[model samples]
Each structure stands twice: as C-alpha cells, then as structure tokens.
Target: MPELIAPTVRLHAAWLEAHAEWGPGFHEDGFGLIPADEVESAAGFAAWVARLGDESDPAKAAKAGGAACTYRWIVEGERVLGGIALRHGSGEFVQWAGHIGYGIRPSARRRGVATWALGRMLDEARVLGMDQVLLVCAADNLASVKTIERHGGVLEGIRNTKLGPARRYWIKIDLPIT
Candidate 1:
C-alpha cells in the first residue's frame, strides 16, 4: 500500500524518474515549487530537501513568502507515486492556490493514486487542526475535479487566474480524520 513519507534523499532516484516521465510543465506544487534544474543532481536534490525542511517552520516559511506547510511523497516502498502538501493557513493567494496541491506521475494516473493520496493528505491537514481545506484546480482538469468531489468537496466557484480559469472547492474536514 502507498503511504505518505517525509522527503528524503533516499528517494532521489525515484523522484528523478517520475519527474522525467512527467516532462516539462509538471507542477510540483507541494514542493515549494522547486525548479527542475534545481533537482537535476543528487547534491541539488539534497539541497532542495533541506530547503523544504526549512520551509516547514512557520517563521522560516513566512520569511520565504508562504504559510507553514508539510510536504510528503506518496510512495510504496521505493517507488514514488506522487506528492502532496498541506498548508497550515490560508494566505492571500488561498483563493487561487488553495491549501493543498498534489500531482501524480503520468505513469501512475487513472490508478486511483491521486485520489488515495489526497485522502491521506486531508487527514494530515486535520491533524494540523484544520477544520476544512480549500483545493483549487484548473477548470479543465476533470480528473482532479472528480477526485475532489469524491472527497466531499463542495464547489465554491471559479475564478480567473494567470494560467486561465480555475475552480475552487472547499472540503469540510472536521469529521474524523481518515
């Protein structure tokens, strides 16, 4: 079974492979948006991991221009299925960026990886004391819309973004954490 794990250099090989498979434009939303070039080498990946660690602290995260968040990779043993991030608080960009963002590799799509990962991430958010969570996705991303809906996400509305139209949904997570 896939489980959430802290980012570690031990998964660098799998991380690189997944990123390569996704090609350009692969969104690493939960990962502090680290550029592809920054993680091209082992040392670079290690540095990126350390940076993510720093960003998890509230003070450091604010200094870096965001709220405190925990980043975790969805993996089963050595294979990385995907990644998810849970932001501790909603900031000015919450309407567009939402509290959580995730991405599953192309090879892992349509296999319920994203759905399962998201469910787990929501649970993580609950543990962090969030009563609910906001999720935004591209208006055209039907799969993501369905995934969010499956988790009881209620459509809040759609708004224009630099990237285009985005749909916003709010998922009440006050119930028992799954």
Candidate 2:
C-alpha cells in the first residue's frame, strides 16, 4: 500500500525521474510548492530538502516568510508516486494556497492515488490539531474538485488567483482521523 514518508535523499532518484517526466514548472499541487528554479540542480534539490526540515519550526519558517509545514512523499515501496504538504498556520499565503497541496505523477493518475494521498494528508492535519482544512483547486481541475468533494469538502467559494479562478473548499476534520 502507498504511505506518506518523510522526504529523504533515498527518494531523490525517484523524485528527479518523476519531475523529468512531468517537464518544467511541475506543480505537486499541495506538496512541491517550491519555485521550479529551486529544484533544478542537485545543490538546489539539497537546499530544498534542507529547507523542508527547517519549515517545521515556526521561527525558521517565519524567516523564510511562511507558515511551518510538514512535507511527505507518497510512496508504495521505493517508487515515489507523489508528494503532499500540510501547513501549520494561517496567513495570506496560506489563505491563498490552502493548508495542503499535493500532486501525483502522470503514470500514477486515474488510479485513486491522489484521493488516497489526500485522505492521508487530512489525517496528518487532524493530528496537527486542525479542526478544518482549506483545500483550493483550479476551477477547471475536475479531478481535483472531485477528489476534494469525495473527501467531504464543502464548497466555500471561488477566489481569483494569479493562476486563475480557484475553487475553495473547507473540509471539516473534527471526526476521528483516518
């Protein structure tokens, strides 16, 4: 079964291969939110991995200009299927980006990978003390909208973002964490 695991160099080869398959400016939806330039080189990838560790500390995260976050790779064994990020605070960026972001490799799409990964991430959010989590997706991204809705996401509204119009949904997580 696929599970969320802490980001590690052991997955670097898989990560790089996945990115190469996706081409440039790949968005992991809620996970690999870093600038594309920051992940282009080995050194850049190393820096990004290091930054991920720092993002768990509020002070360190503040210095970097955002909320503390926990990032994980969704993998079944050694293959990296995707990634997810759970933010631990609120702010303009968080409000715009939502509390979580995630993406699945093209080869892994249409197999309920995103749905499963997202459910796991929501559980992670609950463990972090979140009562509800905001998840935003592009208005045209039917698959994502369906995934969010399948997980009990309620439509909050739409907001204009640089990327275009985004549908915002509030997912209540007061029940038992799955």
Candidate 3:
C-alpha cells in the first residue's frame, strides 16, 4: 500500500509508458477493469491522465497549482490502475466537483481498488485541511456510489448537470480515524 502521490503517474511510468499489454483501449477491452468494472475506458487512459496531472505539464499545472497535488492509485507493486486529482481553489472543483476524481483500470476492477483509492485520497485531503470532501458521480453509477459509501460517504443531493443526472456524496473528515 503506497501513499497515493499527487500526480503520481510519472513516478511509475516505467511500466505505464513503455508497456504494450497495458495501453489506452479505445473500443477494445485492454485491461478489463473499466468495462469489467463498468467504467468508460480502461486502458492507458489512466496513465495518460496521470501524465496530464503531471506538474510538469506546464499548461495543466498552471491552472491546478501544479500536478504535485494530484493523487495516483497504484496496486500490485508496479501497476497504476487509477488515480485521483485534487485541486485547491475556487474553480471547477468547489462547485460541481470536489477535491478529487478517480478511476480504476479495467484489469483491476471489482477487486476493491476504488475503495482503497478513495480511502487513500481521503487521507490526503484530511492532511490538507479538508475537513469534508465532495464526490460527484452519475446517478446511474451504482458502482461508484457503493464505493463512496464504503468509505462513509453521505448523500447530499442529486443535481441535473449538463452531462446527465449526478449524485453528490459527502465524506466527513472529522470522523474518528480508522
């Protein structure tokens, strides 16, 4: 269990960057975690996202206080199945989104990666003065809702975002530490 590092992708790019078995899957079931876990795409998208979350990206880093604040979810040693991005500002985060967003690769789905990843991010948030956190997901995303609940998330309300029906789950950081 490694600490979820902010923009934690590049740290483990040795596999994600060079490997062919695990790359971005457009219509194919590359990793089997996204579609297997019921996510959109589960290939190297996680890795690409990690790169976008990089503090060195310059463009993305400028708006989000550098990628050093993003979090990466790594499991099974060298594999980075998913990650969460944390932004500290009055931007797209505070309104519809929250402090973090996450995804797990297709190959690593249904194995409690979502639960552990969210848990890892929560720990990071608490350490960063975030007494409470907000997590938004589509109303139809039952799997995501369940994962959020596993970490003690309480439902705030449902919002009809432009994308679709969304649910806002709140997690209190003040609760007794587990």
Q: Encode model 2's per-residue lDDT on 1-178: one tens digit a residue.
A: 8988887766778888887777777566645555653665678778778778788677998998777988888898888888888888888877998998888888989999889988988888887788999998899999999999999999999989999999999999975646
**TM-score on alpha carbons, each prediction:** 0.91, 0.89, 0.65
Q: Model 1: residues >4 Å from true position, as ranges?
A: 62-65, 175-178
Best by TM-score: 1
Off by over 4 Å in 2: 36-41, 62-65, 175-178
Better of 2 and 3 by TM-score: 2
lDDT, candidate 3, 2-107, per-residue tens: 3454333344353354233346553221121233322324445565545444543446767666433444545456655555555454456456765566666666
TM-score of 3: 0.65
Q: How do the residues 1-178 of candidate 1 rate in per-residue lDDT, one tens digit apiece? A: 8889888989999988887887775475555654453787888889988887877788998898877888898888899888888878877766568998888887888999889989988888887778999999999999999999999999999989999999999999876645
| Residue pairs whose backbone atoms clash in candidate 2 | 28-102, 29-102, 30-101, 30-102, 31-101
> How far is each candidate from the true structure, as Cα RMSD in Å?
2.4, 2.4, 7.4
User: Any idea what lDDT model 1 has?
Assistant: 0.84
Pairs that clash in candidate 1 = none
TM-score of 2: 0.89
Instruction: State residue 125's C-alpha deviation in candidate 3, in Å.
Output: 0.7
